[model samples]
Target: MNLKESEPTASASLSRRKFIAGTGLLLAGATLKLQANPLVSGAPLSTLFAEPIIDIHQHTDYMGRTTDQLIAHQRAMGITKTILLPSGRPVNSASTHFGVGNGLQAKATGNTICYGLAKKYPKEFLFGANEVPDVPEAIEEIERYLKLGACVIGESKFGVECDSPEMQKIYELAQAYNVPVLMHWQYGMYNYGLERFHKMLEKYPKVNFIGHSQTWWANIDKNHLDQKVLYPKTKVTPGGLTDQLLSNYENIYGDFGAGSGLGSMTRDEDHARIFIEKHQDKLLFGSDCTDITGHIDNCLGAKIIAEVRKLSPTKKIERKILYHNAKKLFRL
Candidate 1:
């Protein structure tokens, strides 16, 4: 009698409680399997902690998902707070990539939507302002949002160098407002000339720069080849710029979100452990995940959380990466 082979009748409506219970069972089974054949030397998820998470990197309009759904998903993940970043005016290249015209308009709409959500759920949600750095009036636009209580400045996906004159101006604004600037650093996509990004770091000593995406994570390995910064490689070699920057720069931070964040951990568990422990102060937990399910088992965010717990030498460090670091950085 294979119960798995049975089909439900049209009238067999599954209750939400039953669906949640089934999902939990499935996740428990998966956890057991991983524990049996651990991916690393020890089981990373052996001791699961249900600490509150602060997701610093999320969008309001990912895949047309609504604010209601996004909030619900965050609640499901035990995320106590989330910062919503709005995309700035798209560069021509970005516009083509996303199949949208007028990046500024898109950003404005996102800001409005996110602001509304934050107003509606003041404790659970916060919003950021965004503008293409190269555009005229960019500073004015950012100032407007800053005045309106925007906590961060970005998701700055532009087709310009990180140290471009326009970006410098925005950095100045961030310094004035004492707000952190979040950047998506994909080599060819956004923030071109990442190797030279250190110049901006030096120039704006007061502004906190939170890095995200493949290029930033790949550089975690010192021996990461220039050609492979956008690609994920298994096995890591120490001496990457990320470690050096975090060690040296007080204003720079890492956003552990998306495939890039998880890849950095799973690629080399040993190095990851050391890296997290070494730079726990500057590292933050984020979920650039777009899935509606909000289940960590199926999300890269969950994998990163598990890996952080496994690698962290102490429960205190795990809590910092999951919540405290973001809380301190954002002044939450």
Candidate 2:
């Protein structure tokens, strides 16, 4: 074959490679429609069959960016939908509770812009209202979102244990609404462990709890740790915490989002290979891309997803973590 004729066969070979390397869990009956040019400036596209993503966690400025920009960015990244939470400062090491007044100050007018986004882009964006237990009228505020069709509650930032009486009440409300509650779990600030989260799991039984941040997914060893070097380093080993939690609790799941989630997957590629293989069904893909103006381009969530996809040679496992697990969890 001459060079010109050989080019056609070579191009076809490359396209086949692209499709073969793409995300396998291509939704129910969805097929990949490859663009003529799958290469975006030398970086390969995830795959032509990349499953549509439903980001379970994302944040935006209350009075910040235009929804158009948010929607466009999400679409560009293959995110078909996302759950939006109000941005709150991390207080102490525990959860940053947001009351009605607090939400207002944070510029998250409960029924303002976010509500509009949900109404306008019902398919691509979901609104999750934040409720701080310390506020007496928190329940009422929660009802407002429920009435408006908010499916989940919180990106609850806490520095305390999940079993606190205040947290119990939040779980109760979640059960009442029949929705899952999302919590940010990290080691440093005010950290809590699997035992604490498990306590709540035991108490509520009915409330579905989804955990995020590094502390939640670090898979730390519950047996022992040198407390001195725990902070940042996090005394736990990979596949430790998640393995136990998924095995013990039926309703609990972890969000692979933010620095912690990305850190866990990248810190040790070998461990990640084993961890994802075992707990693939228990992990949900999310990116803590809450702030609109910061770190959007720099966020490596897409890369992390691609990296995790490579851990296993087969696409079955990747499909589970990328979308199926989350789809079944969120009932989307």
Maximum-TM-score candidate: 1
**Every model's Cα RMSD, please?**
10.8, 10.2
lDDT of 2 by residue, 191-231 (tens): 35544667778888888888776556555435324333332
lDDT by residue for model 1 (88-205), tens: 6545545224534333323224567777889887867898988767667688888888889999998787667788788888899999998999988877667788788887889899
Please provide the root mean square deviation of candidate 2 (C-alpha atoms, Å): 10.2
Model 2 CA deviation exceeding 4 Å by range: 1-50, 62-66, 87-111, 188-194, 221-239, 290-297
Top model by lDDT, which number? Answer: 1
| lDDT at position 298, candidate 2 | 57
Full-model lDDT for every candidate: 0.78, 0.64
Q: What 10-residue stretch in candidate 1 is worst by lDDT?
A: 38-47
Error of 1 at 8 (Å): 38
